[model samples]
Target: MKKNTLTFIFAVGALIFFSQLSAQENPLSVGFKAGTGLSNYRLSGDMKSFTSKMSIGGSVGGFVKYDLSSNFALQSGIDLYYSTSKLDSKVDKSSNKLKSLGVEIPLYGIVQGKLGSGKAFIGAGPYVGYGISMKSNGVNLFKNSNEAGKLVMNRFDYGLGGIAGYDFDKNWQINASYQLGIADLLKGKGGSMKNHGISVGIAYKF
Candidate 1:
């Protein structure tokens, strides 16, 4: 687990470095995005005593995108994201809305084409997020364990995600994105968990 986390961090640094080198030759754009995110955990492995609820959160980030061609480009950025969900434990007769804060590295492959007065585009790629903190009803839940049934949270996560948006003009755009979490976020034994996050919002280019 430590190796994986270190590798992920190294990869993020390498990507940003390469993007910087490419910026000199390619048409590059720097942008900021802000939006609302909806997250839900898919539970598995005999969840006979728990109930799950969807959480709504917010996301804000900046990105650097380099155009490889008129129709293709690559974008990567750092984002701070948040999520909170209610977990009901029937066995313990307890319930709490757990909140988590995390940072993400998003790499997107963008495809573009011209539309009436603007551009229409779509992108798909991968993302890695690391948990910074977690709390349930204001109590810390970070046990730093990945074993099942420990009721602890995992700090590392990686997944495939995609984005689609419309560039209204050169400086502004509207977009929607989704992440299909491929990692197990729960380290406890009773069940496994996968996260699904969706968001919609606006972006600005500079």
Candidate 2:
């Protein structure tokens, strides 16, 4: 219920932002992007049973940007991404693993500064994610499900993200970004799941 409410709020906010952008004189630009992402899970509190590891994946997304001024813009996008990680066991002989597919919606406010003919930009934003599907491979170290009789994997996550990039021209840009999950993604009571990743991608503006 909380997850659904948060998702609704973000969707409404994005809609309002885009609606306002439509009234501006120079409102819209569309683009295609592709990038590689690294994913990891972090454990917090008293998580003695969990271990952290890294996974490499990729993402592709389409974005619409609204130029608020010569120095600022509002950008929003939807992306499809995959992440994988392994959980090691210190006491047990078997390890648990996970693979997840997610759909992410990001809304960003970016500040652009000039560096000669090329432009440099920094952006920070909030992102909401829905885990479309997940697979548990490897061995099952935990034998019991949650209170709802569901596996301890959560289907929703929210996070903060930032990006630094340079535009060579109106149509070409490159960016490096990091996203940190601010919420606990695991459904069970014991461990926390967070993702931190670096991505490099090229964008083509139209």
- Measured by TM-score, the strongest candidate is 1
lDDT of 2 by residue, 104-152 (tens): 9989999987898998999999999988777675323233443452346
Q: What is the C-alpha lDDT profile of model 1 across 61-162, one tens digit per residue?
A: 998988876778898999998887777777887877879899999899999989999999999999999999988755566765444444677889999999
CA lDDT for candidate 1:
0.84
lDDT of 2: 0.79
Candidate 2 lDDT for residue 83 = 75
Q: RMSD per prediction, one decimal?
A: 10.0, 9.6
Residue pairs in collision within model 1: 147-187, 148-188, 148-189, 149-188, 149-189, 150-188
Clashes of each: 6, 0
